[model samples]
Target: MCGIIGIVSHSAVNQELYDGLTVLQHRGQDAAGIVTSDGRHLCLRRKNGLVKEAFRTSSHMRKLKGKMGIGHVRYPTAGSSSQAEAQPFYVNSPYGISLAHNGNLTNSSSLQRELFEQDRRQINTESDSEVLLNIFAQELHHQNSYRVTPDDIFKAVAGVHKRCKGAYAVVAMITRDGIVGFRDPHGIRPLIYGARKTEGGIDYMLASESTSLVTQGYEVVRDIMPGEAIYITHDGEVHTKQCAENPTYNTCLFEYVYFARPDSVIDNVFVHKARMRMGHKLAEKVQNEWKDHDIDVVIPIPDTSRTSALEMAMTLGVSYREGFIKNRYIGRTFIMPGQKQRKKSVRQKLNPIDLEFKGKNVMLVDDSIVRGTTSKEIVQMVRDSGAKKVYFASASPPVRYPNIYGIDMPAANELIAHDRTEGEIAELMGVDRLIYQDLNDLKDSITEGNNELVEFDCSVFNGEYITGENKAYFDELQQKRADSSKKKKNKRAAVDMCNSQ
Candidate 1:
């Protein structure tokens, strides 16, 4: 959904925050922001752009002066893409808290009502992050403490767990003392905390993925457990509390298959290794289902599927080649807001190496097929490149339902596999054959070696919402997304019309 990083260090942490955001840029592309506590006042900088663009000038970086800070890279899963919705959402009350959150909150409507009518707080933006910040600020306000204690932080976080329903991993700057991080009761999102000793003292970082911690030269302590709250004091003391009385660990399985970086590890499971296992398991399916068909060359769709493609090629005794060269300038097509933009991005994002496809039966591997737009375009590209046939392979099972939890697939009809059989999907994509990994194999690949985490939130593929099913709520969300998309389109159209004048 999004990427977040928080740090409590003895030194000015602008460079570290900037670099961490850059590394986690893949998780979000719409906007980036950083909020720092100067001990006296909270310094905030946010904009609707990539991380580097957001901090293009040294002036932008220098404005945020603090030893403790938190940053966010956003991909609008809960709100429309705009400067106003970009996070490190600041609420000027109860220690001047600024919050950045990843994943969506399913009970945001109810929470908003409670904030308005009961708590008498007003939310400024469309972001659920702001709602969360207000709720947290309200809880801390009720505590009525002169100064914040770890116990106070625990109480506020426990209150949040009780009130909010959905996946969230939050990092907030408390303005007076330090930073706070917490995960949802179901642990539907990812959060990890790590620390390392500097010459002055210990530096701590909490991030959506462990890669940020490793990149920032901090050794991972461990994942912040399900429903756990952590506070890193100004003097580098770390305090933790198990806020949720009974927490279930159901992490998002899609992270292993597609979302996370290959180098990052979440819930103690290596994402790259899990994808490789997925490839191995898919190879077993291929051997059983398509042993008669000959795949002359295995070409990965590029980027996320590289590990799985390599392992599948090795197991199937097929040659693996890098067929598509993705342009670094383009963002992920799947996350692009509009269908037209997504289609256009697919054309610009990747270029096929004709040599790999010429006069060969090419099997294309991707992590999954959501709407089938990218898959269809890639299949066409491969066919045009002189490939005799294009076979499609998916690392995970078909996404057959709407993912109301955090993923952007909110409309059921928008899903290509929603009501389509395997044969129908293959026909729709115009591929020679489609091979999908089994749902059971998908679960095993992520959990086979990891002992700390057991299950995953597979709502998109399985149609089972761990948080609870609210069809009316999800339908409302879908309508909101559609309305936002139409507004964006209409605004663009009006600008074009005026320009023509």
Candidate 2:
């Protein structure tokens, strides 16, 4: 998934967009871009680097002067990480629209063919985001009206929801009109909107997380309702309508387990609290599974697992230690786009505190293990740190299937737990024992009492894709990504080896 933000303000919004994107950088970091409209020209800048790196200079920021703007931070789930694939993809139609999207479109491949054959539109990049932008543009163009109204925007989004068959949270700028945002029919991704009245007037903004709003000095209005479309006018008036008919809502479960920042609140639940509940639920199994083994301390894998480790320590009656020192500059290895990058970043991202592991029966907690590449590396690293015995635990269950909604996971065979039992996986990782959260426990932890959210997209573990798309297509998609991941990994390895020399 990616991070998207859009703002409609009376003053220049370049700095605000930059700050919002900085807060969302943890959501994605392979590349970043921002496109702005001064009610006339759409000044755009996108590059294959972090948001700060791309817009680091004063002159670069100066170029993005606009009262309305949209920004994106990207980590490739469908396309490879490249300059052309970075988001805020622009196309000159429907009043010079530029769009940034957060979720994957499962039907994009077939839709691309239809766009070329029927719509006669050429898609340049492999990015599914561009496909989504074109779809909205084509639908808006279908109305064949010179002046577009808020109703036109709603109708266009309705058309998009009717045609598209995957998860998406989109923010689009219609040049002179205002900013419009919508979620897919399934509401598989997240989008939140907020506003603040400055000296000039009310400034309206939308982002992937509520923390962006809080950090940028705005009060959250509420989550943009599932299957809803919002339009912010030039005069700062906000209008919303439910465009999709009878849509099902399922927020991605991984957001609570791993993706979103601890401070962010999504779907009316605090992410940090969900993770703590995850730790508590996981402890139920850990308590009985490891009751016989003498455990000395609970060491979190740093960052994502910190909250869970504390809760798990409290439950298991063990001491909690920040046993791993993480390198802050390195981006999240899990979203690094390729397996090799993730593997290389393990050592580069974290180091063991010798005292915590030296001759101790240490239990390491991680958010989740996807391909097991990093888990293996961390296990080896913990062993190298002189641990008497190492036990492994996952806050979430084993990720056995693919997440077609918006996560990047390798092919079925590439997954470490694809066909292997927990005991087998434990042996493979060289750990004394491995404890995984139960599937039912996972659901209970996220939605035990939360009434606002009814269900979650747990397709990664259950293999029950909510959209009911063909399983064969997902397999092909996974294989293609797996191959690309391997190639990028080998390239990184070669570069690292050369540098060592």
Candidate 3:
């Protein structure tokens, strides 16, 4: 998944966009980009790397002078890790639009062909996001309006909703008109817009998470509804419209389980509260199944799992301890593009504390076990830390399928739980016992707080594509990932040989 932000303020928003990207940096680590529009000109700066590294120099900051802007932090799920694929992709013909997108489009291959042949547009990168931007641009071009209005923008978004069949939450800026934001019909990705009162008028911001707006002192108006489009004019006027035919609320379940910050609220559900509920639900399962278990201390796997682990420990009546110390310098291993990178970073990401594990039965809690690489490493670390016995608990259910809606686990074989039984996975990870949260319980945890959210995009757990059955898409995705993996391996071998010489 990626993080996207848009702002229409009274003053230059380059600094605020940069600051906002840093806050949402956890969502993506591979690349960061920002585009600002001063009504007359659009200044853009984007590169492969973290937000700070991309915009480190004052010169880079100085060039981005505008009252309205859009920013993106991206980790590739659709494209290769190259500077050419960096976001805020621009198309000059369609009113000079620059767009940033979160989530993946399943119908991108067909759309790519359609764009090149039918729509007469060229796609420069493998990124589906660029395809999405072009689709929007083409739709806008179809509007044929010299002066694009909010209604025209909404119509363009409706066309986008009709053709694009997957998950997408977009923020696009028209050079002189306005900044536009829209979500896919199923609302599989998060998007929220808020405003703050200022002397010049109301300054508005649209972002992937509420934390970005709240942290910047903007009062949350509400989440942009499923299939809704919001337009904030350069002069600070706001307009919104429902752009989909039959929109459904199917926010990605993984966001609540792992991606989102605890402080943020999406679809009226507090992330921290939902995670606490996940802990309580998992605790109930543990109590019923393993009443005689010897889980002396509950230790979280650092960061995201801490909230759930704390609540689980209290419910299980076990001592809660910080068994692992995390190095703040490392990015999230799960979001790392390659298996080698993820494997190498796991140990660097966290170090086991001998005092917490020494002579104790330690129960380790993690958000979820995806590839099992990190889980295996952490279990080994705990063993090396003198633990008597090691038990593992996942706050979420097993990820048995690929997440086509923007998570990087596209191949079934890459998922530890895809074809393996819980017992088998437990043995493979070297854990004495493994307890996974049930799918029903996971749904309950998020919906308990907000009954309005009845549906979720849990494709990773159930293999149920929300848009429709995309067997062909899945087949193509698997093949692409396999080819990419092979290419990376061969490239690494060539690099090793060169270094030896």
Candidate 4:
């Protein structure tokens, strides 16, 4: 997943784009980039780091002078985190275009192969964004028009949507025309627009999350509709059209559970509230599973689990305490270099407070366990902190299946819960008791009355693949993951033998 933002303004928009990307820094911390169009040139800057680190200071922002701009903060999904993979990818062939994208394209491998074989277009990096840019460029070239108009841009984007099969939310800036934005047919990723009333007129902005708009002194206009394309011109002319109709809405449920910031509102639902409901629902599961255990304290893994932990604590009538202190210098364990690094990093990332857990029965709440390595480390840390007993509660259900959508998860075999029972998992983690949120409870928590905030693509949790035309492809993907796991194990064994020698 990644973060994308675009703006069409009367004044220079570099600072605005920078501020918006700063607010979206939580969505992606691996890399940051911005491309601004001053009606002539698309000034661009990108690097592998946080937005603050990439730009260094305001002087860097001053270099990009433009009335229209697009920015990106990237978390690698299908690509390596490198300078070449950093986004705001540009193509100046038929017309100068700079684009940033969020979400992964499941059919990108197939599409890239087709492009390479037929058109001989070489893909440089492993980024889906570069593939998207090449696709747009190819479409523009095929049109063979002398002058590119906003309609041409829309048609090109619509064509890409028709050919592509996966989740994507895109923001782009054309050299002369203005800023354009679109969301994939599934609407798996969020894209919201905001407007700022200025002296010249109203400036339009689009961002992956709404909190960025709020930070930039703009009121949220609305979320970009699924299967829709919007174009805003330099003259303040806003045009919108439905590129596709009645697309399946499988907005990522993980956004609420962990990815997005608490303040960000996605698809008209507050993220923090949804997580709290997940906690409340999880509490019900815990109460049913372990009626005899006395829960003295509810402790959250710091940062992401704070709100959900509070809700669980309130529902279970337990005292909540800051049991773990997270090291601010460390990045997220999941985003670290490798599996070995991730396992080691967790120990340095969090430290249990002895005051909160000493001789106490602590119910530890965490968002989710991908591979169980980090969860095991955290449980061990709590035990070492003098806890008499540790009960593990996961806000989301066990992820037995890999997420092909965008989330980076190991294959099914690597998932501790895929083949093991809860009791088995509890023993492995060295916890006294383990409770997982029921799938039904997870669905109900995200839905209110008869209205669901977002339709979930929960293949990872349920093994019920929901892609309409690509059901066979998703089935194949699941099988491929199983096969890949075996290969990885064999490779690791070979490496172990070499080391022994």
- Output the number of the lDDT-best candidate: 3
lDDT (C-alpha, whole model) for all candidates: 0.88, 0.86, 0.90, 0.81
Clashing pairs in 3: none
Q: For candidate 1, write residues 1-501 as lDDT tens digits.
A: 999999999899989999999999988888899988778877888887799988999999999999999999998764666577788898878888989999898888889999999999998767788999999999988899999899999999999999988889999988888999999998988999889889898899999999999998999999998999999987788899899989999999999998899999999999989999999998989898777878988889888899999999999998999998889899877656668888889989999989889999998999999888899999999999999999999999999987766677647777899888999999999999899999999999988859666678988988888888577887777676663564674465456446644
Model 4, span 17-128: residue lDDT tens: 8988989988888889998888887788888789998899877888888888999998765356557778899877767778899987777788899789986788877677
Predicted candidate 3 versus true structure: per-residue lDDT over 345-459, tens digit per residue: 9988888889999999999999999889899999999999999999999999999998888888758887889889999999999999999999999999999999998989988
For all predictions, the C-alpha RMSD in Å is 2.6, 3.4, 2.9, 4.9
The lDDT ranking, best first, is 3, 1, 2, 4
Q: If scored against the real structure, what TM-score would every candidate get?
A: 0.96, 0.95, 0.96, 0.91
Clashing pairs in 1: none
Native-structure RMSD, model 1? 2.6
Residue 48 Cα positional deviation in candidate 3, in Å, after optimal superposition: 1.2
- Model 2 RMSD, rounded to 1 decimal: 3.4
Off by over 4 Å in 4: 57-59, 449-454, 468-501
* Candidate 1 vs candidate 4, lDDT winner: 1
Give the worst 10-residue stretch by lDDT in candidate 4. 481-490
TM-score of 3: 0.96
